[model samples]
Target: MQRTPEPELMDAPEQASAYAAADFSAGDQALIERIQALFPSGLGPRVLDLGCGPGNISFRLARADSAAEVIGLDGAPAMLQLAQQSLEKEPALAKRLSFVCLCLPSLALPKGCSGLVSNSLLHHLHDPLVLWQAIAQAAAPGARVYVKDLRRPPSPEVAEQLRQRYLADAPAVLQHDYLASLHAAFTAAEVEQQLHRCGLDQLQVAEVDDRYLEIWGQLP
Candidate 1:
């Protein structure tokens, strides 16, 4: 499937609400586990989450380490609003978790972040080099970076099959978004080329699941 760019931000109120309400616990937990495994001991004190959506991964990261502070950055205000509301429910995590409204490739992040992670953000980018360049410039030396995103299937028929197989029971909005995302996503080889072009060749790009590709490694 040829890549088709979706809107850069999911800023609509209804869209954000539907996204936040969607149940992604299984995939989110898997991403959290992968991030934890990246560091044998634990994540560093400061972490950055790009395209954080409603803070699912950000909250998980903070919960995994009491000492860690997570900054969740997203381009969507509605999504950030939802994230902020969730923070009220967890007063303990409130102090450790923060959300910023900023679009990627034109990011302004605090320096020296020891860890960075992004989930399902790549396919939304029309030029993925923006993400790779931002990661290189923002990450601290030897920062652990873990990014996971959907992989484009060989054909639209395959994409539809995967969607029916995995997301058949999901909400209509969620199913629509998943199908659009799959069409927009990049193949593993394409992502590897993007990494190489951005001097991020050290990162390991691999297909970790039937529908996802993960890129992880320490920044040079």
Candidate 2:
């Protein structure tokens, strides 16, 4: 299926609310576990969570390592608001975790990041290269990189089947966004090409499970 790009940011009040309300603990926890397993040594002392919608993984990343400082960046203020609200409830994470309102292709991207992880941000970008370049601009020597996002199915029918199988009971807005994201997602081959263009040969891209692709490695 040809990729149909969705809006880059989930900034709408209703849309952000639905995402905040959803119980995605299982998938979020799985991602944290994957990161820990892949980089068992640690994510270094500082980490950046790109496109951190509501601080879901950001909180976990900060909690996973007491010494690690985590920064969650998102383009959407609505989502950031939710993240801030959640942050207020956890005073312990106040000093270690914080959210920033920022988007890709920006010169203000924090430089020399020890680690960078993004979840579901690639598919939304109009130019996929923006992400790869951002990774290069922000990462320090030997920075760890991990990115995971939905993978476009071979056909729209398959996309719908996966959506129904996993998100059948989700809210209408969530369902709409999920399907749109799937349609906008890139395949593993396309991601490999993007990496090649960015000279990011060190990072490895592979299909994970039924409908997702993950890229991970230590930056050279």
Candidate 3:
């Protein structure tokens, strides 16, 4: 597939709106379910959700495993605030999940985290190697990492498939997400190459769909 143009960083307002407008359709939800099935219960893992706008993935992780300690990190303050608001209504989940405002490329992680999960964030990175380094440094040895993101070109056929099969009734937020994700995604093969270039050879990256790729592996 042909590569799409690299995405430019959205400013604060745009970032906030984009996040607000973000929605995970059935396909995205299925991907998350697959991620959830990977973890065993009662392990009480420490998980990090990078670029966790509105804490969607963070909240989902907490819901998937109440015993896990989930931390959400995002660069935009507004997005963080929205996450906080959502947390307000789910006190049980709110206690287990926390949000931090920091760019993934430079943020420090608490030691001994068991896992790391990021969705729709890698494409926004100007230097993914920096963030990958952070993921490597933060996770404990043998810790697991799962990332779901777009693969480029979002062929007209695939877009139409997504629309007809899953997005026909999608909300505006999701529609925007679908389009933006296309522009922001890269091919699975390309992402795998990048992981090796970043010295993340331990990572295993694979494509899950025409628009979605899952990159994961246990840290060395």
Count the clashes in each prediction.
0, 0, 0
Check candidate 1 and list the clashing pairs: none
- For 1-220, candidate 1 gives per-residue lDDT tens digits of 6888888788888788888888888978988887777777775889989899999999899998899989999988999999999999899888889999888767476568888898989999888998888788778888999999999999999999999998899878788888999999999999999998988999999997689999999876
Compose the digit string of candidate 3's lDDT tens values, residues 54-106: 87778877887867899998777778888898899898786689998877566
Tens-digit per-residue lDDT, 19-41, candidate 2: 99999999999999999999999
User: Pairing residues by index, what is the TM-score of model 2?
Assistant: 0.99
Candidate number that wins on TM-score, 1 or 3: 1
Give the winner by lDDT.
2
For candidate 3, report its TM-score. Answer: 0.80
Output the lDDT of residue 211, model 2. Answer: 96
Candidate 2 wrongly placed segments (more than 4 Å): none
Lowest summed lDDT across 10 adjacent residues in model 1 is found at 103-112
Off by over 4 Å in 3: 1-29, 41-44, 154-177
